[model samples]
Target: MKSLKFLIILPALFLSNLFAQATILNTIAADPESGIYLTAADYKNNQLHLAGNLSTNNKLRLNDFLGSRTLTISHKGQNHEFSKDSIYGYRDKAGNDYRLYKSYSTPYKILENGKIVIYEIKQPGHKQNGFKPLVCYYFSEGADGEIYLLSLDNLKKSFKDQPAFDSIDANFQTDYDLIKYDNYHHMFRINRVLAKL
Candidate 1:
């Protein structure tokens, strides 16, 4: 697996516009209103898991909306309405809440102290062409409950120049090529990208 060369995640703003609400990341590092919060815990099975929660009990999950379907061409022999596949929201106020759960594929990586490992990229397509992820598990009093795993974009922004680079742990066996045998056309291959800090 290729190691992550850059740190900060880039242009990681896909859902910022959906919010009339405010994020407190500007004020509190662990603010409920801020951005995604990352929390870590060691499981009795000897594995680490990071959990993140949305800021509100009413929230959205982003991963369920990615990818597109092949639309039939118009009778004019031309394709029509080629656009990003979208995840629909409800007509209720809760539908207005920004989704905190987005999907990303990264190599299994352990945190600085070697007590936690965040697993991602379980499929192929979820792994991007360039960039690595810096993930954290967040647990807060909101509907945004989720696991922390920043994209290559955000990883690039936060750790652009910080000297304290976390070392990637090289344990655990990941399928690595699970997508190849998936037998599904739209199957997303999530590659493992690991970063330590």
Candidate 2:
């Protein structure tokens, strides 16, 4: 009886402690190179769980560790949230329930200057030649609010050729007020009182 009780209580106990929302006062980083905080389930299962947004050197960068999922997007006055851990995607007003959009799978950096830099990690399966694109997503509150898709392969090789881009990844330096899509990033700022559960 005690053993069964322990098993039943274990999950509840673990989840009970986390009843509160993640009140991370940390500045958000696109992805924390420092590392992401893992839950016990994620740690034990060796699963990549989403660690909210990351904070690097006082800058706010969006972060989602479980590949790319669970980030909420306000699309056309409707709250489009990712329920399952799938590639960050969305459909039109009336479309499929799930699918892959042309979004970079890594964390996105929201610069202060309205530059959204998305980092796409090249796994073993997908590799365009020797270089992977740092898919840049540019957005702002003003004229540059739409998502601008720029590729590192295109930006650097504009005056050069794709063959010369024989690198593994691209390193991007971004800031909060200097972020590309911060105008949109601010859309995520939660300032209210509620229960997470």
Candidate 3:
């Protein structure tokens, strides 16, 4: 009887957590406004008026690569289209910041925004391996800086000049440690290194 109750409780907890995550995503996706960051300066200043304020009717479909990989916005009465390469990036209805870092077909999601920005992108995985998608993490020095793979070596190279650089080596023994998120602080563990510096 006890075993039966434990099994039921475990599944209940799992479903509860899954549903909570779904709820959060739905709420974020429901935002009615979208903003476009025209340049790195605009992104830094939180100014989104390059192509004028955008409505979230269609929002942004980063995966849309039908013709020239463009982002079309409707403002006032006319329609304005901006190419991925022309603009810095935009915030979707879900309030997620995506960048055309590598000028890829799909924009990379900005996970953490700060002096050192963290980005994540997903790609299709091998077919034989159950088609599990591949997720890659990258980091950039600043909004306009070049992006590098999120590796311990790259982290060290990017911020070697920081006074707290030694702490990175002391605390993070593996690459995973560099990308670990601190739920308590709501930021990446690596950001702590920047917080001190």
Candidate 4:
């Protein structure tokens, strides 16, 4: 009876540990290099797992295009390529998470993850004669795990019914004014607003 009980409990304990590890993997912080590292178990189970003291120093390379991309991870001097559908998400050394967007067929860097996950997109501004191109940053929030681009106009529409609308709007207006005055800290201010929301 003792041996049988131990046998039964062993598998249960193993499964519980696996689930706990999986949860930890899902919430890992971003790495300094912004490279996606994988644990050996991740490859074995074909799931996303946090890299735990993995010796290989190679950075994962993502080849992205307009609507599709491929990920390449190197291990033991061998490169393994995976398609977009095969990957779920990855965390950087800094604790930032990124996941593949099936609709756009690309990966997006997650800025904030909470009740609403926010992702960042950087777009190149058009250049004119004798002027350098500007980089435009946009953020998108996830609704029920669906990503939707967040614009100033959309933000107003989304928060119109919330009690915190007045405060949020005020901060947004102030940030806009600062941007107009070339303060350049508008993005930080916008993030502060989002945090409050």
User: Which candidate's lDDT is highest?
Assistant: 3
Tell me which of candidates 1 and 3 scores higher on lDDT.
3
Using alpha carbons, what is the TM-score of model 3?
0.74
Cα misplacement distance, residue 9 of candidate 4 (Å): 71
lDDT tens per residue, model 1, 116-195 = 22223223333564444433322121222233443333333333465322211132123332222223522322223222
Estimate every model's Cα lDDT from 0 to 1.
0.26, 0.32, 0.77, 0.53
Ranking of predictions according to TM-score: 3, 4, 2, 1
Runs of candidate 2 with Cα error greater than 4 angstroms are 1-107, 114-126, 131-133, 142-144, 150-197
Q: Model 2, residue 30: displacement in angstroms?
A: 16
Model with the higher TM-score, candidate 2 or 3: 3
lDDT of candidate 2 over 1-197, digit per residue (tens): 99999999999987866653333322222233221223323322324323222221222123357564455544223443454334333222221112223353543343222122222222343366455543434332221233333444333343144422332122222222212222453531111000110
Q: Where is model 4 more than 4 Å wrong at Cα? A: 1-55, 65-68, 91-97, 103-106, 112-118, 124-134, 140-144, 174-187, 194-197
Report, for all candidates in order, the number of backbone clashes. 51, 22, 0, 9
Candidate 1 CA-lDDT value: 0.26
**Error at 59, model 3, angstroms:** 3.9
Q: Which of candidates 3 and 4 reaches a greater TM-score?
A: 3
Which 10 successive residues of model 3 have the least lDDT summed?
50-59
